[model samples]
Target: MEAEACKKCGYTEFKKGKLGNGYVNLMPINSFFSSGSPMIVTFCGHCGEVSSVSVEKPRKF
Candidate 1:
C-alpha cells in the first residue's frame, strides 16, 4: 500500500505507535472475557497529527 500523506501538514514521514496497558485494551463488542488487542496508532512525524488508529489483531475483533 502507498504511504498516505498527513491531512493536516501533507507530511510523508510517519510513525507507528502502540497503545496498551495491563489493565486496558481494545476488546470486541460484547466480549467481556476475551483477551483484547492492542491498538496501532499512525501519526505524522512533522505535525504530530494522528492519521489513523487500528487494532493490531483485527481478526481477533
Candidate 2:
C-alpha cells in the first residue's frame, strides 16, 4: 500500500480496506477467481480530499 498526500491541505493519512468487503469468500473452488487483486486507496481524512489511489495487487502468499 502507498501513502497519498492531499491536494488542498497536503495532508497524508488514509485508511485501507478490501474492495469488496464481506461480499465473498477467498477460495479457489468458488466462482470468484480473483486473478488480480486491489490496491490501497489513500485519502485525506481531515480535508476529505482524495490524495492518491493505487491498484497494484500484492504478491499472493
Candidate 3:
C-alpha cells in the first residue's frame, strides 16, 4: 500500500493491524450463524490514531 498521512495527526507512517479474534469477527446484522470476515485496521504509528477499519471480505457481510 502507498503511504498516506494520518487524518487525525498528519503522520506519514502507518501500521497495519487486525481488530478481531477467532470469535470476534464482524458479523451481519440478524445473522448470528453466519461466519464473518476479519476486520483490517490501519493506524498512524507516530500518534496511535486509527486511519481506517475495513473487512477482508466485504461481500460476506
TM-scores for every predicted model: 0.79, 0.42, 0.80
Model 1 poorest ten-residue lDDT run: 20-29
Error of 2 at 9 (Å): 2.9
C-alpha RMSD between model 1 and the true structure: 2.1
Task: Give a tens-digit lDDT track for model 2, residues 1-61.
Answer: 7655667887677655445343432323343455554545666678766555555444531
Candidate numbers, best TM-score first, in rank order = 3, 1, 2
Pairs of residues at least 3 apart in sequence or in different chains that clash in candidate 1: none
Note the Cα lDDT for every prediction shown: 0.87, 0.54, 0.87
- Looking at model 3, which ten-residue stretch has the lowest summed lDDT? 2-11
Candidate 3 per-residue lDDT over residues 1-61, each given as its tens digit: 8668888888898899987786888999999777888899988999989888899888987
Reference-based lDDT, residue 59, model 1: 80
Which scores better on TM-score, 1 or 3? 3
Where does candidate 2 clash, by residue pair? Answer: none
User: Candidate 1, after superposition: displacement of residue 17 in Å?
Assistant: 0.2
Measured on C-alpha atoms, candidate 1 has an lDDT of 0.87
Which scores greater on lDDT, model 1 or model 2? Answer: 1
Question: Each candidate: how many clashes?
Answer: 0, 0, 0
TM-score of 2: 0.42
Cα deviation at 21, candidate 3, in Å, is 1.7
